[model samples]
Target: MKVSLITATYNSEATIEDCMLSVLNQTYPNIEYIIVDGGSNEKTLKYLNEAAEKHSNIILSSEPDQGIYDALNKGIAKATGEIVGFVHSDDFLADPSIISAIVEAFKAQEVDGVYGDLHYVALENTAKIIRNWVSEPFDHRLLRRGWMPAHPTLYVKRDLYKKYGVFDLNYRIAADYDFILRIFKQPNLKFHYLPKTIVKMRVGGASNKSLKNIIQKSKEDYRAIKTNHIGNWLTILLKNVSKLKQFKS
Candidate 1:
C-alpha cells in the first residue's frame, strides 16, 4: 500500500535534516513524502530544497500557515496515498523499518488504523530517554479513562478523514486529542496496536512549551471530552495523571 507521510515544519533547521533523513531512509518504497513548511527561515528552506532535489517522491510546499494543525490539514488534502500519517518536524521514525511494519499491520489485520508506542527523548540528545508512551489495544471504554495512542504513531486509511473530517482549528493545542476521539469512537471502525516504538519525539513541543499553554490545553481537552460525549472534568484529570507513568517508564 502507498503510505503518505506528512511533516509540518517551521524554522526547524536544527532538526529538519534528521526528520527528512529518517523518512527518506524508510524501508517502504511506496511512500509519498509531503512536507508542508510554514515559511521557514532561509537555512531551513535550504535543507528542504536540497532534500527535495534528491528525493523524487517528496512534494514540498512552503507558505504561511495558522499553526501545525493547519499545515497538517493542507498535507492531508494533498495526500493521494492509501494511508496517511504524520512525522512532526522535531520528531523522527524510530527506525527505517517502522513504516514497513505499519503497512504490514494494515494488511495483516485489515484494520482501519494502526498505532504504536512513542518515546519522548531529550531535545539535545535523542538517545537520552525521557518518557515512554506505550499504548494499549483499542477499547471504546478506555476513552473514558483518557486513554489515547500516540498521535505521531497513528496511521489510518485516508478515507477515514474524508468521512469523519479533519482537525478542528478551534483547539489550539488539543486538536490531536479531539481528532483522535472523533475517529476512535466510531463503533464500526477497527484499530490495531502494534507493540513497537514507532516514533521518537523531541521534548518541548508547543502544547507543553509553557505554563499558559498547558493550562489552555487542559481547557481544550476538557471541551473535547464534553463535545465528543466521552467523559467530563474527571476524564481530563485522568489524562494529565496518566502522563506520570510515561515519565516513570
Candidate 2:
C-alpha cells in the first residue's frame, strides 16, 4: 500500500534535514511524502527545495498557515495514498525499515490502523533518551482510563479521516487527543499495536513547553473527554498521572 507521510514545519532549518532524510531513506518504495511548511525561513526552504529536487515522490507547500493543526489538515486533504501518517519536523522514524514494518502489520492483521511505541530524546542530543512511551493493544475500555497511542506513532487508513473528520482547530494543544477519542471510540474500527518503537521525537513540544501551556492543555483535554463522552473529570487526572511512567520507562 502507498503510505502518505506528512511533516509540518516552520523555521525548522536545524532539524528539517534529518526529518526529510528519514523519509527519503525509507526502505518502503511506495511512500508519497508531503511537507506542509508554514512559511519557513529561506534556509529551511533551501533544504526542502533541494530534497524535493532529488526525490520525485515529495510534494511540498510553503505558505502561511493558522497553526500546526491547520497545516496537518491541509496535508490530509492532499493525501491520495492508501494510508496516512505524520513525521513532525522535530521527529524522525526510528529506522529506515519502520514504514515497511508498519505496512506489514497492516496487511497481516487487516486492521484499520497501526500504532507503536515512541521515544522522546533530548533536543540537543537525539541519542540521549528522555522518555519512552510504550503503548498497549487497543481495548475500547482503555479510553475511559485516559489511554491513547502516541500520536506520532499512529498510521491510519486515509478513509478514516474522511469518515470521522480532520483535526478540530478549536483545540490548540489537545486536538490529537480529541481526534483519537473520536475515531477510536467507534466500535467497528480495528487498530493493531505493533510492539516496537516507530518514532523518536525530540523533547520540548508545544504542549509541554511551559506551565501555561500545560494548564491550557489540561483544560482542552478535559473538554475533549467530555465532548467525546468517554469519561469524567477524573479521566484528565488519570491522563496526567499516566505520563509519570514514561519517565520511569
Candidate 3:
C-alpha cells in the first residue's frame, strides 16, 4: 500500500534534516513525503528544499499556519496515500524498515490502524534513549483506564481520516489526545499493535516542555475525556499515572 507520511516544520532547522534523512532512508519505497512548513523564519526551509531536491517525491508547501496541528491538517488534506502517518521535525523513524514493518502488519491483519512503541531519545543524541513508551493492542474499554498508543507511532487508513475529520484546532497542546479519543471511541475501528519501536522522538515536546504546558495538557486531556463521554477526571488521572512506567522502559 502507498503510505503518505507528513511532517510539520516550523523553526526546526536544528533537527529537520535528521528527521528528513530518517524518512528518506526508509526501506519502504512507496512512501510519498509531504512537508508543511509554518513559514519558518530560520534555516528550516533550506534543509527541506535540499531534501526535496534529492527526493522528487517530496511535495513541499511553506505558509503561515495556526500551529503544528494546523500544518498537519494541511498536509493531511493534500495526502493521497492509502495510509497516513506523521514524522514530526523533532522525530525520526526508529529504523529504515519501520515503515515496511508497519505495512506488512497492516496487510497481515487487515486492520484500520497500526501502531507500535516509541522511544523518547535525548535531544542532542537520539541514540541515547531517555524513555520508552511501549503500547498494547487497543481496547475500547482501555480508554477508561487512560490507555492510548503513542501518537507518533500510529498510522491510520486514509479513509478513516476522511470519516473522522482532521485535528481539532480548538486544542492547543492536546489535539493529538483529542483526535485519538475521537477515533478510538468508535465501536468499529480496529487496531493492531506491533511490539516494536517505530519512531524515535526527541524529548521536550511542547506538551511536556514546561510546567505551564503540562498543566494545560492536563486540563485539555480531562476536557477530552469529558467531551468524548468516555471517562471522568479519574480517567485523566490514570492516563497521567501510566506515564510513570514509561521511564523504566
Task: Give lDDT tens digits, candidate 2, residues 33-124.
Answer: 99999998669988898888988999999999999999999999999999999999999999999999999999999999999999999999
Q: After superposition, how far is residue 226 of candidate 2 from its true place, in Å?
A: 0.8
Query: What tens-digit string does per-residue lDDT give for candidate 1 at 54-167?
Result: 999999999999999999999999999999999999999999999999999999999999999999999999998799999999999999999999999999999999999999
TM-score for predicted model 2 compared with the true structure: 0.99
Report lDDT per candidate: 0.95, 0.95, 0.93
Candidate 3: 10-residue stretch with minimal lDDT: 240-249
Off by over 4 Å in 3: none
Q: CA RMSD for every model?
A: 0.8, 0.9, 1.0
The weakest ten consecutive residues by lDDT in model 1 span 240-249
What TM-score fits each model? Answer: 0.98, 0.99, 0.98
* Predicted candidate 3 versus true structure: per-residue lDDT over 1-249, tens digit per residue: 999999999999899888998999998999999999999998899888888888888999999999999999999999999999999999999889999999999999999999999999999888898999999888888999988899999999999879988998999998998889999999888899999999999999999999999999999998888888989888889999999989954
Evaluate candidate 3 by giving its C-alpha RMSD to the native, one decimal: 1.0
Task: Let me know the TM-score candidate 3 reaches against the reference structure.
Answer: 0.98
Backbone clashes for every candidate come to: 0, 0, 0
